[model samples]
Target chain A: MSTKSTQIRLAARPVGEPQDSDFEFVTTELPALGDGQVLLRTVYLSLDPYMRGRMSAAKSYAKPVEVGDVMVGATVCEVVESRSPKRGVGDLVLAYTGWQTYAVAEAHHTRRLDPGAAPISTALGVLGMPGFTAYAGLLEIGRPQPGETVVVAAASGPVGSAVGQIAKVKGARAVGIAGGAEKCRALLEEFGFDAAVDHRSATFRDDLEAATPDGVDVYFENVGGPVSAAVVRRLNKFARVPVCGLVANYNATEAPPGPDRLPGFLGAILTLSLTVRGFIQDEFVPTRHDDFLREMAGWLRDGSVRYREDIVEGLEQTPDAFRGLLVGRNFGKLLVRVGEDLTRE
Target chain B: MSTKSTQIRLAARPVGEPQDSDFEFVTTELPALGDGQVLLRTVYLSLDPYMRGRMSAAKSYAKPVEVGDVMVGATVCEVVESRSPKRGVGDLVLAYTGWQTYAVAEAHHTRRLDPGAAPISTALGVLGMPGFTAYAGLLEIGRPQPGETVVVAAASGPVGSAVGQIAKVKGARAVGIAGGAEKCRALLEEFGFDAAVDHRSATFRDDLEAATPDGVDVYFENVGGPVSAAVVRRLNKFARVPVCGLVANYNATEAPPGPDRLPGFLGAILTLSLTVRGFIQDEFVPTRHDDFLREMAGWLRDGSVRYREDIVEGLEQTPDAFRGLLVGRNFGKLLVRVGEDLTRE
Candidate 1:
């Protein structure tokens, strides 16, 4: 049988901040599932800062979604019809179903998710890509040692919160920087971050300095802008910076006027003996993904780690929710609940 | 017996380009050598760009030259008198004696150099700190894979020359960047670099692009101004930037006018997944120095690596020779002939 899938397709390439004009809602008919294919209904659609990159034509680690294409994202879906033995109907699965409510994916392409183990939605957040990004980037690149200080921005979000928590797990002090007192409080109170500094505070620089007495040894870079610049200035000698995302500048139209400080930036890198490495999450999958799964799941189970899901009601809320993500409006792991999960409800 | 030692002391810290008035020359009396102590006559005094850092009071890996302190440097000296079993009268040695005609040091503090094995001046150039800077930083941090492209600036100088030649030894394509046609010629003819781009040339950017068609895999960053800016722009994904020095900005009094490109720089580090590491060569001593000595000696013997020296006639000419090094005036490894080597003649 077939199903109707409602998707948010790329309407136009964004100039700066993505607008309603940049996306178009479309309902398409899915053809009958072929052999070795599974018809899936997306229970939870992931909304991440990385989605902004897919919206633009800019060159990045991954290819941008072309105009007239479905906006891509990780989805926690329910298998509705299976044409292969690899998956069964009513089984929860993880799939790349983009911004759609339903998809026809090959059986091998979808991983079966056990509903008994935590929640299926986590495959898009803490137990999945975002968590793995924090894990692999922080440990492999940052390599924060005992008694060292790790600083991460966007601290209330999945990646930054995970980075802070992981640094603490490694015996390093975690300093979290967020946009407001509310988020900063959540960083320390909810995520158990060692310290939280409000990036929007009038005395943000002073607060950052006060938060990290020993200086930042590892800076898990998620938000890149003035916040990153201030943090980088306070980096200790031999500091490690793992550049995971630049959500701050995702909407920038052009480079700001400059005396061009790339030289001074390089000068600081030289004098301080800094290690600045940029990476995406997938690079460490072969070796680190399993460890991330086992560890993060344990941390969640034992109450050592906590997660918050900010779920918008429907597929239509995806764009606005994503726009909120770039501006630090989302409080935690942002997700769009496109349809009811039959496994739970 | 007592002897008179002529030394150059820092009269004051430099503001930008070091002035003659910033230095004071003095002839002081030295007492008779004690047990295990040696009185040495300076042979070759190494003049390097890192000295610019020492002339400033800024924080660095090593301490700065204090006002009224003898200007610190690496020196090749002849032992005029020794009161130890480790060395006898007339033995050549390497010592941190600074810019001076003579010094009194403990015999164990100096490493005796065999004049019969190689020219004693080599201990200050290709076989010393600069060469080791190239060796350790390039191998340990840069780690250029075979068939990859390795680019280094200051092409004819000790560090950059060794970096290019060693890159060739490791089966990578070595591209050299220098200031003038003469240095550019030496990069190809003397150092056997695959391509040489003159930084002073108007077509430098285009030339660099042509030279590095596969994109820069490793950039041995020594100079950090426009040359570095151009090189960094062409770096491939996962490029290794072992930032050994920033000779171009060593004398800058303030941050240049900015569109403040640090954010964009961080963005590139994120998008390209570049590995930018800064280091001082001394950190790798215990782990890699022995390997450097053995391997570099073999390469020099087989002519797989070649070196050149620009020797100034007298100690009084040291200041001019040093000033020349910062502006790419000297053709090769710069040295000052502080006192004649009787063994060589």
Candidate 2:
């Protein structure tokens, strides 16, 4: 095994769509682990839409990734060596190892995942941050009551998929909006959503209206743009919108031209008594994270929840996979298979 | 006594600022009071900015007044004749008398107000709907903590003045914004706000920045326009905004030009974890109206909460007074003294 680790470092902040020139590949010798630190080999590196926000120097909920830093991501890793009693050499763990093949982290920073319990890659998808985001933002903010209609865009993606399924679990009707027929089909078939509308259809707005005949009660706002505008019009009185991400505009170089819709938006918020809240998953850690873990694990075990992954073959495909994410090119949770999984081996 | 009652009814929906041509005044004999009903002599007709929403045929939180219907408003009335044991002749009551000189109301529809306990005019001002709006929207939605900055616009108006005074009462720093120096002075001197910024000043943004040294935590949004855009830039993380009214845009015929601020606004909501809620004061009647009356009455009794009135005489002047309200012409709670207040006279 190579003692040197390879990493993709940010070369420049992209103006719009990230290009290969925006990232630099580097190979560096791994430093010896310190006391209470574990050496982790990256088996899967999670590439998420939020990373797009982090790449920009603009102010956001979290600090932006500085230039020349390893492109930040969550990773499922195999503990290759341990300097603490908390983790063993072959244990599977979840760590924020970024876009790297190997990383060293304090043992406290890693969470051990039982290999026999589920696939370790699930740690990068449904049972991880994306899942937690959907669970917290939907239940805590979107708050779909039983029989209420819940509408979500990017319904084939991890966060959106989970939101639709969880709305079903809570006895709410789930109506999903996705880009194509295939994704719309998956939303209905795989996620068990009550209705699926193709956002890319020429009659997108009409399709949304047809799907949500009673008007939407909870809108899990993952993909913002025209889809959001259409969804907002159909929101029932007292609708709750949990704004988790706006992947559609993450790569825009400038603001959209407008007859400023904000006033109209605020008007809807007032006249409809809508609750529009924006959040990241961490806020609910103290209150709901444990409940999420226990409930999510049970659901996954009982086949009540299902997840799909769109894995790229190598770390070099990170930029391309991420570009595809912004344009709805990926069918599921996008992740890079950075290295071979030793957990199963 | 004029046996005939005079009323101002909606003749047409105005394009921008309401015009006299939009209203038609008519004198008609009121129906005879029946069992459990009282003939109320309109002593004070309250003219609020929300009346503008009712004038429009557009969809809103409340149903709009149809053309030829009497314009809706709250009033302090005297029981001229009572057919129910619950109320007697010469007693003052709070009633929805609209823009009229007299109204016959069911006893159940009116609340008895003691002129001996407080000024009866207050039932239409600080102790009435506008006062409760600030109380409920600020406390329930804004949730300002002690030492945190709470900002409100239209500072000298009934709703804004109450928000500032109540925020100060709660140990929060109160910053008020008004359109002119006179109103700004009233905010600081009469209302006892910590700081008052003139939204019409050339240095308005700078004044707002200087006033809110600690970023704003609670923004009682009574006015929405350029002033709001400036205040929003300084909101803190986890800041709460209780959108009670948008008086600034109540007269807007077209949406303002923009670099589509909705995206930037949504981005801020996400990054700051903001809770943006729009509410009509009625939602809190079953929840908090009693507490408001008790606490506000105590505050008034002890001279802690000071109220101002811009009383315009005669129901015939409601259109002009209401027009003045939209432009900040009336400094305080705009009330039309439609009839003799025999409770004191």
Candidate 3:
């Protein structure tokens, strides 16, 4: 049989909004699988805001993806052929195979997914890195106490959505901040938030103030811009800010123009005794990953935690979809449907 | 016998720098001590940076010093007349007697100080609250691992000086940042810091970079402004920042003008995965104070820790000395010598 695969590669780093030229799509022949390795066909590709950081050459907790390399991403795939004792002809698995149609990886690198447990796509969204990020960061660092208000920006995204829901489960009030009225409505209804404030509203500040009467105890910061500034003003003494991302300024090339509010922010921290912690999900994997898998699975099963996916068809649409993820264009957990799901009922 | 006592009271909230009219010095007669109380004559009054927060009507971790009230402060005092069996006449003790020369306090409110254990004035400086602040904040939150770099600003101040020394004791590289060459020199010679960078230098940023080659793992932030901004750039991955004070902008009335840099600061937090925790020393007193006292006493006994004092003379000069403390005029722990120590050897 003919061995062929389609792949997406980074063409150039985008300045602000990514353009079509920033990615190159190529169709090439797949290499033959070796001993103890499996040939997998991509089914679903996760497009996340973090991919923007990997595209830029800026120094970060993780190394940036080199130009011309396959854009790094997490994918749910179907094992087409296996050369090892772990026989998997049609078994679905999770892999970090980047933006490619097919990849040859060691069988041990892929974790087999039980199709009966949950949707294979759920492994890339709710039951994966983004969900676990919310679990570990909020529980371990944020520590939202009962009756306290927990505020999260980008509240419709996977990480923020899970954060708001988990805070509710912990007996805390969840106040979600999203871009528009629709997302805000989704946050309140779909995500089960106590209050949802539209950051895009002209009266957003007042809305946030009205939403959090007792003031915010834990602010799960993912979007740092005017939204974060407004939220910071309403924080109570000894508030905990677990910074997970800064999607608002991901494409920033220079420092924002300023009356220089750094001094004021620092002063607030000193006066209010705030705790601002920044973390990546991987840091908590060794300690809390197992707990996350069990708890998140249980939450999904019980309908306590809900997740939404905004799927874009085909691997060719991955680059444009990723750009939309950074600018808050695509709602929910942005994903690209790479290939047909043969196991779907 | 008739007793005349002079006291400083807050007359009005100062707009920027405090003026003479902002304080009212009154000579009052002291009443006789009650059954369980002692008449105290203030010897050394601690004039700290936190007093600035108290003077303002702005909300803080602590309540503001109301207008027409005696400005609060910590003091080392002598018991002139004791009606209680717990305290003897001529006993030296640490008290929260504000800016008054003489006052009556319950016996249990004061802790007796032995002149044999360092000095009576040490109760208000290196061996007291400021010292404990450095100890607990650095050890508990800062958590500097062995061989890692620990950077601290206000290198000559009691809290910062102790921070550098304690970090060194824990086998970490201590880098002190001070305003002038004299204080910087003292940081290395007296406090035993690995390196002391003069923040006033034209090439301060370069100096900081050269001093902390491995990047700062722990930054005990006491002075916030350009010094802190410089330190933030050198922070390593997962750096811990225990924000103790922001003396630089204590008098700020409004948010400074900006192409706002707060977003950028948050961006760095996300990329570096840093932990910035702000705290007041009182919060940790119940849990860690006893351990601090034991370990600090041992450090002082073995000469592993050293401290400096910038003592201003007399109770009448408190208002002017307090103004100096906020502007970093006082070199070490700013203390006002309120009364004569006639018992000193």
Candidate 4:
């Protein structure tokens, strides 16, 4: 096993879209594992839109990643050296080792992943934070009733796909909004969304209107921009918006210019009685984690839910892949294959 | 008794602030009372901020008052002539009589008021829609826990005052924001608010900062403008905003100028995990009305809650009184005395 670890750290905060100059690659000697700790080799590093927020000096639910600090993220890893009974060598586990090929993590901080039950990488995608965000935010805050229409953007991505499928499981009519025709097609074919609207099309507004003839009841807001503005107009009275992310605005350098729509939005809130709630998934883990693990596993087993992953080849592609994430360049749950999956070998 | 009702009708939609020309005084002859109907003499006509929305063609929770139609409003009335067994002549009751001296309404449409229990005028203010609005919106949506800080603007008005008092009743510290020093004084002294900030003062923001030592947990939003914007900045994580009104924007002719703030506000919702919920008081009538009546009656009886009123003389004064209501000229619940209260005599 290699005694040195190659890691990516934040070099400087980016102005808008993150660039290559924003990241610094470093090689460091791995410290000897302490008691109750495991030295893990990263097999997959999850790349998400929220990483964009962490890269900036912005006030968010989580603290911004400081310059020169290792970029924060969730990773699926293989424990290579174990000093605790909780984990053994060659055991695959879900860990938050960030953007590094190797990390010495406390054994209790990691959860064992059963490869036989499901693919180990599924622990970082459909069975992980993103999936739990869909489960808790939709069911707890959105509260979609039977026959109600639910609209979500970034429809081909992990959270959005899970939201649509779960909305279906709850007997709701799911409408997916994606940037391209291909993603929209996948929303209907692979994810089983009731309808899909291509937001990139010139007739997007009309398409959205036709798709949501009954009006939207639950809007699982993952991407915010003109698409969200259009969707807000189609919301029914007493509609619930569980805002989990705003990928479209994550790279914005300044506020958009125009006849300020804040007052107008507040007017709609008062007149239509809308509920707009923002949340971080961790807040729900204490209450809904067990339910999410059990129900999502059943859905995966029964084909009630399906997930797709877009895996890049190496750790060095982190910066570019993340930028692509904010712009919806890569579809599915974007991940970086930091090292070889030795278990599969 | 005169067989005519002199009313102020909507002449035309106002450009910004409502003007005298926008209202037309019309004297209409009353139709003969039919079975199950009563001739009601309007004693107190409530002039609220919502009336401004009714005068315009803007989309709102309720329909706008049509041009050439009598301006709609709630009123306390005396039954002058009855043809139904449900009500008797000289009984004090609550009715939707608009800005008129007399209205012929079905007896079943009016709720009989017991003058011995409370002042009959309160049936239109503290014990009416405004009171219920504060009750249901604050309790159901705001849900301020004990030891939390609750903030409200237009704190001298019926709804705002009731919201502050009720927050205190729930064991939360109440902070009030009002337009003038006198109103702020009333908020602290009369309404028993823990702290009061004068929005008209130059030190308004600083005062608000000092007032809410513990960040706001619940914001009962009745007035929306700079006051609300400032309060939002002071909100703690997971704060709740029960938006019941936006009186400041009711007369806005067009959307405000460049640098749209909607995105920033939504960003705040995301980062702080805030819940911004809008509601019409009537939605809670079925679920919370009985509890409100019982609790509010007890609070008033035991002096736990206190109310104030600003009564304008004559139905003809409604137009000016209503215009004043939009600008916070009236200090308390604004009402027009349309006719002499025969029961008081």
Candidate 5:
């Protein structure tokens, strides 16, 4: 059986911050499920900063979505029909089905989720890519030791929140940096970060200094700009930085104004004996994915780790929701309810 | 009996290139040997780019050489008199005696060298700290896999020369970047590097491209400047950079002009999944020293690795020799023969 799919495609490469005119929406019938394939009906679509990179033709770890192609993303969906013995109708599964209402994917390509265990939508958030990114980047690259101070910016968001919480679990002091007083409060109170500094404050640098009494040891770098520049100065000797994302510069049309700080940073790196490693989460899937699933599950069950979601109501809201994700407008794990979640009903 | 010691003290912190006036020469009576101490007659004094950092009050891994203090460095010294069982009269040993004609040091602090195994001056260059810096940083951090392309700057110097040879020993393709055609010739003919690119040539970038047909997988970053910026662009996905030194920017009084390239570098790091690690060799002494000594000895004996020294005749030439070392004037490991080698007799 075939189903109609409403999709958003990249219309043009964004010059800077993506505008509405850069995306084109279309409706079409999806191809019938093949022999080892299942027909997926999208329920929740994730909106993330990485989407900005995919919208442009700039060089990145992943290939950009083409002009006429559906904007790619992680989606939690329900299997409506199946031609394979692996999946049954109405089974909830996690898939890379992009920003569309319906998709046909191979059974082996998607992982079935147990809705009875936790909220199915979490497959796109805390239990998914963002969570895994924090897990792999922190444990492998950052390697924060007990009593060491581990700092992360955008701390109210899914990846940063997970990073801080995981660092706490590893017995390190977790210091978080976020945009506003409210997000800072969430970081300290809800996310259980030992300290939280508001980056938007006029006294942000001083606030960061006050928060991290002991110098930073592991900086989980997900945001770049003045915030990262200030944090780098406060890093202790033998510090480690795991660069996962740079949301601040994703929309930059041109290089920022001079005096180039690269040499100074390199100098600091040499004098301090620092390690700065950049990574994409998918690279860790083979070795660390199983451990992440097991440990994170326990953290979630025991209430040691908590998460929040900012769920938008409709599929059409994806563009605006994504724009919000880039500028610190979304408070938590941002998700778009693309269609009805049958399992919730 | 007693002898007078001639020393060079830092008269002033240099603004750019260190001038002869920045150093003050003084002669003083050597103190009588105390218990567990040896009176050392300096033979070969090592002069390296790191000395520039020590002349300044800027924060670094090691303490700065305070004004009016004898400049600190590694030296090959003779045990003319001893009050300890660890050293006997006429024995040659490695010592941290700085730029001086004679010194009194604890016997326990010096490592006795076997003149029969190799030349005594080698204890300050190829068989000493600089050689170990190349070995530990490249093997530990760079981790060049077989058939991978490894690039190093200052390829004719002790550290870079050893780095290229060691990379070749590990079955990786070695590409050397040096200042002049003569050094580039030495890199290919004398050092056995697979390819050599002269950074001073007008077509350097194009030459580098021609050398590394497959991209660079490992970059041993010693000289940080325009050459480093160019090498950074040629790095492939998952490249590793072991930043042991930054000689090019060591003399700069102020930050180079704009637009700042730090963001772009960090962006490339993220997209390429690079590992940029900075280290001082002393940190690895506890763990990798034994292996380095054994393996490096084997490589040297088997003709898999070779090194050259540019020895200056007198102690007074240090100031000029050091100034030349910073600007790539020295062809190899720059050393000063501070006094007569009694072992030659």
Candidate 6:
């Protein structure tokens, strides 16, 4: 077993966009596993937009990962050794091992990955938490009927991509909004979205207006900024807004300047009888997890749902890769290849 | 039969708080009534906060009352004479008669009011649409569970008072927020609220915090301003907000200055899994109106629910009375006694 492990610890609570100095990489010795524990080496670390929330001490659905803690994350790992009766050495498993090369955890804390079904790395991306979030939030809350328009921003990310495709499967018109034309084009060509609007265009508002002529019925809101503002304008009566994440304003240092528009927004809510609900996907897990696994596994098997991953090399590159996530730099599900995958079939 | 009748017509759209010049009160000769039409005399006119929405040309759930037209309103009137066999002379009925002393309406357009069941004027207050608004919005959307704390503002008014009491009937703790000590006292002593907080007091924020220690499960939102800001801070996870009106901002000529807090508000919505829905009572009328009528009528008969009315004398005082309603001057459901109720049994 490897004695030394490389880990990234949070140095400070970021005020807005996180900086490199906010993290400290350290080499630490891994302690021996207990009777029920296993030694695991991380092969892939998932960098998600939600990590931005955990970096800040702001009130949220989950507690912010404390400063100086190995920045918390999900990882796909190869089990090095096991003391538990349930596990064996060389097993590939999924774990919440944070930004680290290796760690020791209880055997029950990790789920063994079946590489025959798909690539082991997929346990950290497309068939993982982000994908599940989109599926549950859209189906349970958005509840788009056939022929209704489903609008989603951050369209190229794991969650948004899954949301758009799921809406299509439900027979709803999927409208994807992304930062540039490339991602927008990918939304239509790769993800099978009915319409894709480039939010970076100077005429983005007009483009959105032209694209969704029937108005938005279910807005799977992940990016809340100018894109959300434009979407709000196009919302039809009785529109449903599932507030999953607000990546656009996650780095905000202070409240934006205003002739406060909340009253106007509330006026729209009243006049249109709109339903604006905010949710974290974990709330729906207990009720819908089984249904999700069965349906998503079926969808994947049939090629009804497709996904992409943007993999970065090495644990040392995670900080830079994560910084790109907030500013829309990465093209797909951003993951850092922490270690070599030696168990691939 | 009298040929002359006085009518109040919308002269021009008011920019903010309505002015006397914006309403033109003119005496006009009544047109001859055709078959199936009845000549009605307005007895009690309902002056509600929603009338303000009609005065504006902005798009809303309902069409805007056009300028130069008689200002739309709900009225309890006496059928003075009838050309239709369905409505008899001297019958009391609820009609959409607008702000006029007398008007001719189709006999089928009005529902006969039973003076014996309750006072005829109660048709415009507790036994009518405003009361039903409180019932449907609270039970259907707010859905306060037993032992949960339900909070409502404008607690001295018809809608808010009913919400608080109905919440109590459902085994929830009812916290009533009113503008002054007297209204607050009425909420506790007269309406049987579990707790009453005076929003006018300098210690209102702390008082509200103390009153709702377990956090608010349902907020029956009628008056939205500082009161809403205070109540929002006390919302529990999965808190349901049934937004019925925003009386506090009704007269605002400009958006209030702010370090815009909308992002923060949306953040709270995400973190708390809050459900904020805006609805006009009429929307639910088709589905839940019968249920509301059965439940509210039973509650009133058993003394489980009570109501208050603030009656202003004569049609001439309506403009000032309405201006008062905008600023929370009237203590309860504000109504105008247009004429004597001679047909009362």
**Candidate whose DockQ is highest:** 5
Lowest lDDT block of 10, candidate 6 chain A: A336-345
Lowest lDDT sum, 10 consecutive residues, model 6 chain B, at B1-10
List of clashing residue pairs for candidate 2: none
Cα deviation at B207, candidate 3, in Å, is: 1.9
Q: How close is chain B to the truth by TM-score, in each candidate?
A: 0.98, 0.97, 0.97, 0.98, 0.99, 0.98
Could you tell which candidate, 1 or 4, scores higher by TM-score?
4
Q: Where in model 6 is the C-alpha error above 4 Å? A: A343-345, B343-345
Model 3, runs deviating above 4 Å: B31-35
Please list the Cα RMSD from the true structure of every candidate, rounded to 1 decimal place: 1.6, 1.5, 1.9, 1.1, 1.2, 1.3
Docking class of 6: high
Which of the two, 1 or 5, has more TM-score? 5
What TM-score number comes out for model 4?
0.99
Candidate number that wins on DockQ, 2 or 6 = 6
Docking class of 4: high
Error of 6 at B218 (Å): 0.9
Candidate 1, residues B1-345, lDDT tens digits: the string is 679999899999988888899989999998888999999999989999999999998888778889999999989998898899998888889999998899999999999898887788888878899889999999999998999999999988999999999999999999999988888998888889999999899999999999999999999999988898899899999999999889889889988886777777788888899999999988899999999999999999999999999999889998878888898899889989888878767
Worst 10 residues of 1 chain A by lDDT: A256-265
Candidate 6 lDDT for residue A268: 78
Candidate 1, residue A8: the lDDT equals 95
Ordered by DockQ, highest first, the candidates read 5, 4, 6, 2, 3, 1
The best candidate in terms of lDDT: 5
Each model's TM-score, in the order given? 0.97, 0.98, 0.96, 0.99, 0.98, 0.98
Isolated chain A: TM-score per model? 0.98, 0.98, 0.97, 0.98, 0.98, 0.98
Q: What is the lDDT of residue B38 in candidate 2?
A: 90
Instruction: Report, for all candidates in order, the number of backbone clashes.
Output: 6, 0, 12, 0, 1, 0
lDDT of model 3 at residue B262?
A: 84
